[model samples]
Target chain A: MNRILRLFAVTLIAVVLVEVGYAIPSFSRKYKTSCSTCHYAAPMLNGFGKAFKNNGYRYPAGTDPEMTKEEPVSLGSEGYKKVWPEAIWPSDIPGTSPLSIWGIGRINYAAMNDVKWEFEFPHEVEILYAGTIGENFSFFGELEFENEDNQNEIMYPFALQYDWSPGLHIRAGMVHADPTPNHLKLTRNHYNIASFRSRNRWRFRDEQIGLEVWGAGNGSGERGGYTYRAGVVNGQGINDMNKEKDIYGKVTYKIGGLGETGGTAGAESQTSEFFIDNSVTVGGFFYKGTASRAGFNDEDFTIFGGDVDYWYDRFIVNGALMFMNSGMPGIPERKSMVYYLQGNHVIYPWLIGLIRYEWEDADTDQDAVKPVNAFIPGVTVMARANVKLVLEFKMFLDDVNKKNDTFTLQMNFGL
Target chain B: MNRIKIVVSISLLFLLSQPLFAGDIKGKVKAKGVKHSGDAVVYIEKIDGKTFDVPKDHAKMDQKNLTFIPHVLPVLAGTTVDYLNSDEVLHNVFSPETCVDKFNLGTWPKGQIRSYTFKKSGCIPVMLCNVHPEMEAYVIVLETPYHGVTAKDGTYEIKDVLPGKYELKIWHEKLKGASVVVEVPEHGEVVVNFDIKR
Candidate 1:
């Protein structure tokens, strides 16, 4: 009896040792990432975050030091580009301490007196990274300006994430909804809703708000391919508040198929603020209006839309058709439909060309005649990783006709 | 004669039934040739026997104040790891290598913990915050049970070794130190040293 008991104990001990031995290295390699990176709290992986990991952590270029331009041999606390065989100077700044800066200035058509010149001072000013304060928290914000104050804004992507399982997660806070079809169209897209609409649309506002929660089917914690997001948000976009209380919900689906051999499909339902990854999306929304003030209606409105997008490595095509109808007392029943087709081609990593055609019509003849057909051809140049310079030529026909066929050069940046 | 026989039998029984216990082993670690402090991870891997009380959690690699602290983490297989962020910004963490499980925690802010359980046993090279491109950490997952880290002065000691043969491993971020096989005799002290590349 004693011998058998001792043998059993020994066997148990052996099993545990083997299990621990096997588990140790596996545990170490499995958690290579910090918890906060994926979770709104910890140990969680959101849609975009998962896509990023699954995509092998490959992101847009010029954003990572390991992938950035090589450093030059120099002698200084702060690196200075020395005029040598390469005819280049060390562009990396000094005393910046965790703050890395990249800037671009274009003095094009200089000889022409109305010189189309633009300066982007530290245009792509992403802080690289500030610091992490604990196992579950950290904070960083980015400020950007373009054309020396023509446009300026700061983006704070504060988030908290926690993992429920290897294939499950929960998160909360303000973070960019996984890039939407509208977002993926890139600025190179000519028919983007933002570029064509004269007034802020209800649906576009839904896609961008302060709070969201998204998940996926695989929950493998990868960053690319098919994924989905559904969330509740402040119906009104940032910096806009009305007397009427509102809650917004959106559902988005994305996938990478044959067309996106080296790219992805992205779309969003404007009516509900839903952003889709890279796929066809169908959406619907309803919102209550605030009391009439300054000729605005107190009656609510309902909006719905279907959008589809296709993307190749460098080429993209998309079309979105939407209907917005308002049912307010006293005002005539108002209904409208807007649709646009856009195409984009990557001329180079830093350069892209776009062409778009859009048409908008309202039941009211007055709304339909406002120069609905527009031809916009534009080019976007990557002045830096997060900074871009665009030159767009706009030609309007019929209705709201004006000689705004002007030359506009602008620079934009984001962190 | 009978007394001597009994003592010999008891000693034999103790040797066979229970492993020997030795002095405490401890150490700190330092980066060999860099002004920047390297993140070092220390762990022990029991070679052949399974010890249930010992944990299998992966050592951690954290980003605080724009730097990866304790950059090196050592662990045995099947351990849980806790990744903490001590910063004032959001970060996305992920690794694409096949040897390790990949995950991206998007936009994590202050006071958050992401945990992962490693099921495979091997070393994995990790990168950080797809959004914040500068942070990095590594997981040195080993199969053996004899692992430990060196002190800031690059010294280490391991104790409580049962009589057995173990391959001692010492690792430093950016440096691959030498590994040696040593036997821990019953209740005896053994000295092992290593020199790493700068």
Candidate 2:
């Protein structure tokens, strides 16, 4: 019965994709522009796209009304700005609905020691809301539904942000704790350093409910500059387990390529935003938090990580190293070291090839056979500006997962 | 024999003396799904045996206040266009359309000018600035000089076109209009109207 159900779902999704016609609309429909303006592929932003995101979902020049095709409905008139304290400040809402629907579906075939080729669909259907409320206020939200263990699992993450300038902003709600540029990766899998959860369930990539101040400064493109973010949160991902708060901070310095806000006038790429990025960005991050359980021994952990990204024309490569320990006050038996190196090249405007090597040493074990060591290779094909397909194979080299290698073919799109 | 030759010469002169027929074509285009009906290029497509002289003076397009002045420009083939940057900041121009050779004009400060000649007819290229992705314009290269730009009221007129059966076409960046077959008579006006849709 489970096998039949999976096959039915795959056929149904394929039919729906064909009937929906070309493109999955989002910002493109609102601004009356093509998806290629921001995305090298769906969800993987390019140089100008980074600037757009950094500027709080509006154009980098700070909320240009002319940038949008439909004029937003004004809550009050522009005259209210001149009157100031005499009247309340006015704002505008999107002329069209801000909500956008997109989804990801994967058909996987796995090979393991005890099982012949098994089938599991890694599925996600999401509704995303993102836009600027006015000149200064912006918000982003994602309501995601996933299929896990033949059950529907749901999660919603959101952020409300305020823009003060091109260089500074403040935000609240679920915000990322690291500055790893995970959105730039072409693969479907998360970086090992970003997702490797300690026994306490502490993860670096998880979004935490928190307040944060972040900024990107210096319009230096080929010349170097920096962007930094810091926040204080309850430490837990979705629910609070204790009254103590967790704090995390990250900073990155870009040595070349397009800057956080813009780029040099003549030096910028005229052909493609993705391929022409030539830069080296080095970053460091840290998170300190404590885990508590009912009638159990408590542990305080501190995680330190460093990463470097190199972009040379059509090629991009990244390396991350992380160390986490609960021995801050001399507690033993809890420590881990992890690292991953990934590289990708844009073979064509519609194709990309990538490979990643991940290694982890958990529980401070010096075992001759490492349990978590693997290599991943993948290719992404963008059939349209909004529809993408990725095929990946994860091969484990350790004694534990040597016979549990997996391969995945995934389709991702957004409207 | 001398008289016969003179008569033949007189008959040939009479045949050559017949005047070429010419007339004006006027029309109105109702464009749907846009604020204005103007900016649509209405022209006669290439007539197999016809050729018109290219205008010697160059057409001008200006970048001022980070906006492209005259968002749409229609020019005859073999005509040169002078792109002028009138803003204080630097700006560059490039088009991705392969029909136009995919040319790029490097960035320059205010008061500088660059030139490109439209050698291919029927090439419509969307012009863009690398520095300002929001800035855009279009250059429509036509094969014949006989064309007219629609007014705010969607009315247009092509004057002194050689009288013949021709295809009168309408082009809008976002709207599709039907082409009409027009038969023009000597010194007379032919009206061809269109209703373009989304």
Candidate 3:
């Protein structure tokens, strides 16, 4: 090899070493508690994870940095907080209720040969807050920017959260119907699954405009182990609504010893014990699109699915299967199903290994189609209660795919 | 006539000596640094080697408004705690571990009462409603009756503490362990303030 080629190879090797070396400890410290605590599995965000995201990823950072090397500085730290205390501030106003900041960053690198390498640097930073002036009403706004498309263009997840009663809450926001197990994009990065545009041009706004009603069961044995959420969305994505929009709804039911719903390990998460130790969710959505659109041809579409999640101590296994059939002709009258068999073991009190085999296939590959088979294996290390680092390896099996194998390294700390 | 007189005399002597040794050991147990509106039980245990007995009528736990009325209730071994759920919804009560009586009462609807008799008391625990995972109540069963729950302002005043060399102990739901200990002089009201550490 010539000198230039040798230099390129050396640089590539150095980057890979850093990435792999950093990833080793990253996997060892991501889920220090238990897998059942934060996720049903990969791409499956449990109740606690949702709260952490909604709160802009802020969580109580206990004392552990002194003992562990991967413990990232928290929002309370002098260096990080001083530079960005309002992690996702709107830049509109200052000095109002102490700005709250949320951020997620992804660093990816892949090497195919001695002279070729692919790299992507994308991150999302947001600032948001929710305030209430009176009973039954609250307003929330989240401004976010991603590096892939626009440099500083903002995407807002704005909405109003209403408390209808002790058992029910309603939210009307420009929000996605929460990317469940089926909706998640299979990718190496931990922050995001995948984008429809990455594979196809006319794919946007999987979010629909709608209202969601959610409730927790009262302690009665008959109703205790269930959490129900249902809503009617635009049947498209978010932010863009057309006249052909349809109503969508989803209901999730979890049955287990109390506190299991929150996916945490103490009284802070669950309030009761388990007489009926199990949890299951079944949901279906329908959309009526009569207007003419560019991507969608017909006037109607419907999606139906059911998710079953069970938690037995340190082991939690869950699977979700959804079917979407578009009324538009020449759309292959699609039936798409994505399912995974996941197992999580608490290696120790603070170390966790989560392995999952995922498969996503559709009836037709018309536009923006994803791979049919994906073998994903991931490990996370929860060095402490508040700090986590994750390392994931994703292998795609297909001839028309480049960058067939990918590795992801991520570190997250809240509060 | 002689046998009856002997039995009656023995019974009278046993009753006469009970008050002297036991001495109505009445005192209130209090916890500090809690702000939520709830109650907790305070308990006392006598160290007779490894054996102890909790008074039957001394321990009680209550649930109201879908929350444990007293968040903490300390009790002794072999004690019967009245687990009352006063909320409009039904409550199923059980503890997965650390107690012998792990029974679920199904659904006890509004304005109803159910009771559980704790036979083996080593730190008997109580949890509520498998459905309402946010509704939690704790009953810490010890081996003595020398415990009391804290008041609204985090102040606990244990009254009628028998004047003796007694080891005073305190506990809280969030507190890690016993707050502190003190010695009580005979017929003396000792003011012990516990600054519970998180």
Best by lDDT: 2
Runs in model 3 deviating more than 4 A are A1-102, A106-122, A128-141, A149-153, A161-172, A175-206, A210-277, A286-371, A380-388, B1-54, B62-74, B80-198
Model 3: lDDT equals 0.46
DockQ, prediction 1? 0.02
Runs with alpha carbons beyond 4 Å of true place in candidate 1: A1-50, A53-185, A188-192, A195-210, A218-226, A237-243, A255-295, A362-371, A383-387, A412-415, B1-198
How large an RMSD does model 1 have?
21.9
- Per-residue lDDT of candidate 1, residues B1-198 (tens digit): 999999999999988765555434444454557663334444444455555433744567676644566666666666677777654333446776667656554434446666676657656657555533446777676665455555566666655666666666665667766655766666757766555666
Write down the lDDT of every candidate, Cα atoms only: 0.44, 0.75, 0.46
Tens digits of per-residue lDDT for model 3, A157-189 = 556766554346677874345334221322233
TM-score of each: 0.42, 0.79, 0.53
Candidate 2 fraction of reference contacts recovered: 0.00
Task: Judging by DockQ, tell me the better candidate of 1 and 2.
Answer: 2
Residues A261-294 of candidate 2: C-alpha lDDT, one tens digit per residue: 6534444233444345577889999888876655
Looking at model 1 chain B, report the run of 10 residues with the lowest lDDT sum.
B36-45
| DockQ (CA atoms), all models | 0.02, 0.09, 0.06
